[model samples]
Target: MPVQRIFFGWPVPAMPPRRIAVLLGSIALFAVITLVFTLPNSIPSGPSLGRFTDHKISLPKLPKTFSSPSILSPFRVAAHPPPVLKNTTSGDSKWYSNWNWLSPFSSSVTLDENRSLLPPLNERPPIYTYYDHTQKKAADLKAADNALLLTWRRAWWAQGFQPIILSPAEALNNPLYAELQTLELDSTLKVELSRWLAWENMGTGILCNYLVFPMGAQEDHLLSFLRRGKYPKLTRFENLGHGIFVGSKAEITAAVKTALDNPELKTAKDFISTVPKETFQVDPHHESVAYYDPVVVKNKYPKIDEAISKGANGLEILNKLIISHLHGTWRNRFSKGIAVLKPEPDHMSAAIEPAFTLAEFLAQCPESPMPSSCPPNRPKCSPCMASTPLKISTPPTYRNTSELYTIGTVPHPFTMAVLSSFRDNIDVPWIRRESSRDPWITALTKEVSGTGVSSAPRIIKFKEAVASEHGTFHTLWLTAEKEVPQDLDWRFGFTIPRNATDTGKSETPVPGPERRPQPKPDPKNGPVANPDDVKKERELLKRAKDFGQARTPAEEKLRGAIEAWNLADTEAWRFARAFLARSRVERLKWEEEEKHYVGGAGAERGKSSGWGRWFDD
Candidate 1:
């Protein structure tokens, strides 16, 4: 036989089956040992959006030194429990906890303090505006405006509304944006067109049946006016002064479709005019301010026009103004210190007051000796950080919390809001209460699991119906029931600690979560790990493993409940993606058919079939 030459580690000649098998076995054994030893130190995976349910659930190998605690044993706690942190100002820690860090829910009692800032879900109107960074003039104008955009957002946020700031780049996602790109319209006209197109995109696609408004950047709606419902309600299409128009989803979408059909309507203003108006009903009067020269209005209000005719001063004219559209002309006068408009004390709420006064903002400018840092007395630095609280009165309806059946509609905002609030907050690195359980957790788990049934259904049986011709259903739920417990027990154990904290410096660290100290760098020996520290870490890891291995009756129940809801929630997201993807494909197909009918020889036949009848089907 020819002498076999070794290339690297293996012989050049093919090894015997027995030898190869033995080598593979040895490698596998080593991997198993390494994984077992390192698993305790490994971090749990973060939350993922898609393909959550289909993935295989693997149980992590227990550490070599891990001692399985008794089923009745309690969780291991720190030797010394950290002192309960107190608020000196309030003298009660309960009030601090009530803030519900970044959560969208609040108690009915604290509604005014928390949920008062933003309108509750279904009530919050989207204030749409456009910005063009490509234009030098517009860029310079916005840049020099000194936090005008920030102030504008705060103004809306204060009134419980979130403004949607769109740009030409953002509009690229809209299918209609392609048409805008094809046309070479005037830059100014294009800005207007792009804004409407983007708004139409949002109204039709995301927020169906929702009312949306387009407002100028410089324009500000009085908080009092909005609270009092003074803003114009459009039955068809009504201009609410200062070029602001509010319309329903159908009306706006119809207008945009008309624009796309008619090539003559090039400008955004033209699209607004295309919006169907009620011929019978008269247009409402829109208030305008003539505080300074060159006052412009969409429809003149008797009060404002009369004041201007009587030669009313800045303050007098300002009082009568409901929505102040301080465009370039008004802003220019302010910049040159030519015009001054001030409101009375009672009218303060009625005016478009920013989070901070202009004087306070100016004091903290870069030119000041002590800049960049907020003044000790002033807390205006971190504006718009308040959470948009949930409307407790409107709990998730039965449709959303219905389990065992697919609803085809997404989970209610209330259900989502509750999930967002409690998911992170309630995760404590401690044992479940032996006596009583949290009502919120019990309710939420049920809601989420039920919601998942509708939102994320296991459509494996019906795969052929919903599945695209080319691709099969993306992800199906895990078939085996045993996998759930193993996955939850091995992955999260008892609880995944919340290591994050709020912005307040004086606030105490989140209780129960331990932070490991990093190894210090030495001059001669480079980074050196302390043997004692390493030993301590191993002990802690062992203790943690023990705590997880041994679960109380309550803990065991809690773990199972958590696993059930979590799996359902994961599946819900997975199903939603597959469902939406299928819908998109169907939409594209319909659009193709529509194009063929519109442009092809079958135009008359398609019209006879009925416009948009296919979509309804």
Candidate 2:
């Protein structure tokens, strides 16, 4: 009966197998399509993805052995010949066997035996020799050797040459030559040897035998030796003159000129030439004429001609000419001669001494009577006209003349006399103290204090008079009259009265007492006082009464305001205003005190009235 409701269940429908088969087929197809598209797109491509085409050319094969003739056939294996073994019978066999067959065509060839392989004795290396063609010829082979040995010895004595050594037997036979020949030299020796050869046209090998050591035969021995060490002589020639061995005359001249161009060589030449002829003879024939000739030419100018003209006998003239030539002029020679002469005494002193004393030497000699010859002026003559011969006392000998002269001239007798006179007369008395005298007593008495007119006498006279009359020495006193006391009574006693008092302090009258104030008259009786006047009077009275009150409302308010202010504020402003008002009142009281009071009032009364009014109002 209660709204019967019907609930129905919907039945589940079964799916068709064909439709399911269709869906499955479609999904399968979709998946296959997706996989096909994605797999190809997602996969990464590699380096070997593209096909490679290499076009390499193949090389032909080489054969192991070669044929004898054809160039290509030589590389073929089949046509090659077999190796043959070398025979060991002769020396050549060992040589052939030792020869590197692998390097068959090498440039070098070794020989097993030295003697058999060498050339015949006739074809041996030549022996070089050098001969000296000097003025002193060699007497024999040993003598020639000795000369060469001496040259070598001299070379050794010079710088850059080394010592030579030899065996005792070797040293004994033509010792110097043997020693030279037996020398063992280094690369430096070889270079020096080469230089000597180039310089003297000597054989380098001969020089080497004498200067350097014996070495085994080497190909290009000379060239190798030269290469190892520097021949600075050659280098210097190449750099500064013509290259080695200046052969031509022009070349030799050029080389000489180039050498002269060097400042050191030129300076050396100048120095050598300046050397004396005696000095040139030091090394005998080996003297450097290159250094001496130019200097001699320069210095021996006119003298050279003079010497020729005079031959050897005109010695004085020749000497003068030589001196003139050396110095270039006669004046220069004269100047040098003057320098050589010892300096004369100073002319000033010499002239003064001759004028005054004549003991000092005169620098200039007197002219000779003949004008051709004169002796120098002698200081031996006496200066004083005294007929006695002058005795010149010589000072003790000194190491030098200047010292002697100094001691002799200074401290002269006249100078010492002047100094002694000055010391005794002028300087002695200036150092003593003076005497004192009584000035006051002498002056008061008006008498001459002493026999002479000394300053003490005068001062005493003056002081004596002043002290006697005035009790003090500084009192006033007349020159001619007697001194008197300086008092008013004494000066004016006769003209003025002596017994009178001053009378300047007279007694003043005493003031009367002050009268009482009268009462005010009725206002109506006084000539009918006007209303305005009455009003004015009333107003004035009112004002006075108001002033008389302690304070008006406004004044009180102002006072209250002042009182309300802090003490600090009062100190800043209000206290000052109040103090000023009180001071004005006090000032008025003081003024009244100073004045004469009118009527029956004294100064004190006026002051009291003023003070009372000021405070009451």
Candidate 3:
């Protein structure tokens, strides 16, 4: 045996020097391979494909009065309550319960078998009235009811109210919004009839008049009788908006000053432009005077006048003194002196006339689809006598005035306990029509949906308001130019109503603010760049952005190494030498590191590098 030694389980026979060198090299290579597999050192995920390319990337504000967020926002989204089903009890009211469209009269749903569904938004409940599929009449609403709802939604419109305009007129350099509605209400609730009455001692053709209905025991009896399929109204009295007007002493004084200063002012638009939007709800910074604060002013105004008043804000004094303006004295200023700009005759014929008779509608019965089953053939019954009686339809007004008028059920804060105790008995459901908008007017006018301008409007010109006995030939209404002004602030509900679209086909309505049109880009901000440049810039930006978001030093190093390796074929020598040097170093380290596996952890501390490993202690 030529110089043999047993260093491990097998006998290591000393070979020739060349063979020994080869065996040593092979051992070192195996250790390097083992270290590559066994060591914790890692080169991330993408670049280590033996080198090449690796790159990649990756308010809780509710609108309006719904200001607060839900408690469950941190976890799962809170389940929205289900919509009211027909004939269901009131307890199951859901988020969309207020969305009473497509449901049977929700008013039929009773609270504790006594109350009606016609309560405040907070107190209203699910509808219990079922419309049987077989009942064709139930399936189809009386055209009059549709017309009434249509009209009711527009009840507050008048030339004197704040004018909400969609487009500018060619006549004058018209402001987009006409100061139309009187922000300073000049009428009191105590008056049953209007102070602006157009009649000779009779409240006929009143502008900006309240549509009062019988309240208290009278309202209950009528509503109860209505539930039993009876008359629409027991009394001739009807519900209305506050027969409101737009003047106060300050308003009148400023307007007189503006008028006196500018003799050329002829049109309402000119007068309106001069009135400040700060006087009303149009100012976003504050709300309309709180409903109750007016009372406190009445009791305390006298006491303040009793003393030499300090620098008490005059604005508050005017706000308080403004209360007296609600009397008849204030209304005379508008009705007698001012000439109003009004729409041409409103299409009230449909609302004023009954579309069908009781027997006529009932004739839609499967047994009788013939004309004989309709009106004329059947004995005429009063429109008010039918189940879907000619309910109080709203009189025609302008496209909802710019004023902060809501066309909901009347006398919200009931003055009498009778009106307040309405929930004590079963009454009709809250009408789906709150006068927010009229779908019929929408359909009839063929208004371009998003644009406020009517595409096929019947009336083109606005006529001046005429006195009651003046044998009026025309009615004044708002007119608009085809082009909507770009800079003008449009009013009305900024929040798109989450109701079903007029297109009847969509089942699920989206919930959120309606999307506004993209504003035209300003050239001053930045000129439009070439697409190719944009794309190149974007790519460069992506590279730069990576440094901030995700790229690590190790990753950058690995990426650089990969790029170098991939480009090595053309300029190979430097990279080849560098890689070989690193490989050799790694190989030498692993050779001694492998001894730790064979001889255990203690041996690692004792191992050496280069030729020193041959003398490990």
The C-alpha local distance difference test score for the whole of candidate 2 amounts to: 0.25
Candidate 1 structure, TM-score to reference:
0.27
Q: Which lDDT tens digits does candidate 2 get at residues 1-617?
A: 33343447554455577989999999999999999989987877865433464654568876744533454654545433222232222211121222232221111223222101111111111112222223243234334333333333222211112212122222133213332234344444323332332333311111222311111111124323332332322221111111112132233223333433344432332222322333211212211001112233234334434443443333333222222121121111112111100011111121112111212111112111111211111112212121222222222111111111111111111111122222212111221221122222222123334334544334333322222211111111111011111121111111111122223343434452234334344321122233354444334433333332466675555434332322121111211122222223333443354243111111122122121221122
lDDT of 1: 0.32
Which candidate, 1 or 3, has the higher TM-score? 1
lDDT of 1 by residue, 63-93 (tens): 6457545322476542332222332111100
Off by over 4 Å in 2: 1-57, 60-131, 138-225, 228-617
TM-score, each model? 0.27, 0.15, 0.15
TM-score between model 3 and native: 0.15
Ranking by lDDT: 1, 2, 3
Q: What is the full ranking by TM-score, best candidate first?
A: 1, 3, 2
- RMSD to native, candidate 3: 38.1
Identify the runs in model 1 with alpha carbons over 4 angstroms from their true place. 1-123, 137-140, 184-187, 204-242, 266-269, 275-617
Residue 176 in model 2: shift from native, Å?
34
Distance from true position, residue 458, model 3, in Å?
A: 19
Q: Which 10 residues in a row give candidate 1 its minimum summed lDDT?
A: 488-497
- Residue 456, candidate 2: alpha-carbon lDDT: 33
* Candidate 2 steric clashes: 18
In order, what lDDT does every prediction score? 0.32, 0.25, 0.24
